[model samples]
Target: MVPPAVESPNPQLTQQFLSSALSQRGPSALPYSEDTKWLIRHHLLSLTTSFPSLEPKTATFTHNDGRSVNLLQSDGTVPMPYQGVTYNIPVVIWLMESYPRHPPCVYVNPTRDMVIKRPHSHVNPSGLVSLPYLHNWIYPSSNLVDLVRALSLTFAADPPLFSQRRAPRTPPSHNPNPNPSPNFDSFSSGSSNPGAFSSGYSRPSIPPNNYPPSPYASGSGRVQPSPTTTTSHHGEDQSEVFKRNAINKLVEIVHGDVVGLRKTREGEMEGLFSVQGVLKQREDQLNKGLKGMRDEMEGLEQQLQMVLMNSDVIEGWLRDNQGKKFRSLENVEDAFECVDVLSKQMLDCTASDLAIEDTLYALDKAVQVGSVPFDQYLRSVRALSREQFFHRAMVAKVRAAQLQAQVANMASRNQHYAV
Candidate 1:
């Protein structure tokens, strides 16, 4: 029969499958648990250790230009002293091959760019810290963990780059040339455009007519129209005065518009607040239900995780417990077997004891019959007693050997908990 031809995979389908796989994989699922070489694996964090909040992208050990220098990525919490208050700071320590012999290099991993360099006390231009402990590091005595702790203390005396970047202090109160308001008197500078120098309200221009004394006067209310008034003599009519007064009146309209806007906003806000109370009550009811369900779901998820984690510990405990019980039972069974064997050995001893009893009975019967001589009977009795005594000694030695063998076997098998 002819072999069937194999169908070739469609390139489009292959690409689609790959894309779906990548999407579902989702950034390695647990980045820290990937396969690594033995050298790198040895330095990786244990189950007991807390992982760094900001770990390097790759956990691989870096080699320095093919030299013996190997840099291991380590990150964890370090105790920090910040202004009389102690805080835990995260740091990265690089371990080299000549580890205990040489102090590991350390850096503050605050997770953002900061003023890394000097006049910055402990920290060097390269971002490497120079703590007193690091400078005089004794090969075997000085460790990386303590060195990082010292760097944290150093930061308090010299605040970090970000700490110095606080909001600019409330603007200085002193101003040599205090501008009370825009000088509308100078039209060229102030009235070039309405928007110029307009911070909320514009300064009103000074009126040329300082005539009638009014109740709202800031300074001398009426300056009797200058003795040398020119308007009348220059053929300027009352229309000119009327026009100037009207222009001044426009400034009052600006103030009126501002007041109207403020009132409209306040009224609108009051209406919304009256309606907001009703909506807030309804929102609380719905939110309570939604939040309760969400919390229940989260609680269930956490409970399941806890149970699964406990299962491994439980299994280990059960296995060790079962093993100990089995060993104990085996020892008991062996003891029973040994006792049975010793009992069987003692069968000979029982026979010897019975023989002694029989010899006495025979001696009693002889004395009653007066058939056998008293001397002969006494000689037989002595020989029988001697034989019985010999057998008892031999049996005792054999019984001891049997017990010793059983004890040795148990001790060998249960080496750790042997009695």
Candidate 2:
């Protein structure tokens, strides 16, 4: 097609284009509004000057394993190995463009064969992969070099291992159960190194002459000398004797203070222990008393149950003994009728006895009236008969005699006449 031939990419132009592209994003990128030519020039200057100057050099760092590791920032990525762990390395600088404004990206590029248990881990708990001490770059209008240097030092120190490790927070106290576990923090032995022992550094040692008097010795107004005394052999070199005497007095005073402190502590501990023991004894007694009361209540309840059962039994027996038979009206009527019949029979017997007595009395009265004047009555009858008979005889005799007498009288008359 006889078209114009395409020109090859210019080294400068290619570099410029790549720089412009790289500088468009990120905090360390060049100004976004800059002209292409200026952008190219800016990127060119950064490549030729800034990048080589900024990168950390190869330095030997000692690891926890007693092994020395060579560290450096290289093209692509440099894998930092620590404690059988590998961390992805970040680019130190980009040659094409982006100045201080565009910090480079990092990747995990392992040159040596390694095992990564997890990816995208972090030193801080937030899991943010960050440049240490570079919080200022995160903000605007700050020195980026210092930030980079701090990041460099953090990397050199290999703080990921330690920063990831944290001491556990204090645990919550156990309650209700009241059996408190021992305080682990109080019992744990701390490392002896000053750096490890406390956040504050140890104070520098003072010389013997510079040492302050002991707090205990201060009350006695003197400082004690060491056993290795610095003095002449004289019993009393005035100054030396005075120093010794003052030291002895201070020692005595310190000893006395210690003795007092010990006594005070002992008394306080004894009082606490006694109070605890007394409270325990009172609690035990209260529990025992409650138990005794419960036992007594149970016993009383049992007795009450037995009494109720007995009452029920007795009631059942009484009901059975005094049952319907005894309560029947027919039986009661029969008993009353029997009593009336017996009363009537007794009355009849009494009437019969009274009638017998009257009959006997009548019989006795008839017998008394019918009884005779026996002999007098008999004599009267006999005499009446005899008197009649005798009267007849006398009449006859008189008649006879009269007849005779008449005869005689006649005779006698005759005789009398004769007389």
Per-residue accuracy of model 2 over 169-248 as CA lDDT, tens digit each: 34345344443233423222333333433432232244523322221121223333322222112233578446645654
Model 2, residue 205: distance off in Å is 39
Deviating ranges (above 4 Å) for candidate 1 = 1-70, 88-90, 164-419
Clashes of 2: 7
lDDT of 1 by residue, 1-419 (tens): 11122233344553443333223345432222122222123223220021222132224444557633223445544433333333344456765445544555666654321223235666556556567786687633344434543555565455432211111222336645445334332232324343332332222233423211221122332212212211111243578546534543653465467669989999999999989998999999999999999999999986675566457657876686573445556465453332365666766676676778787788879877997788888887788879877877867887677556655754675796665
Local distance difference test scores for all models: 0.47, 0.40
Q: Against the true structure, candidate 1 has what lDDT? A: 0.47
Candidate 2 weakest lDDT stretch, 10 residues? 108-117
Evaluated at residue 100, the lDDT of candidate 2 is: 30
**Using TM-score as the measure, which candidate wins?**
1
Clashing pairs in 1: none
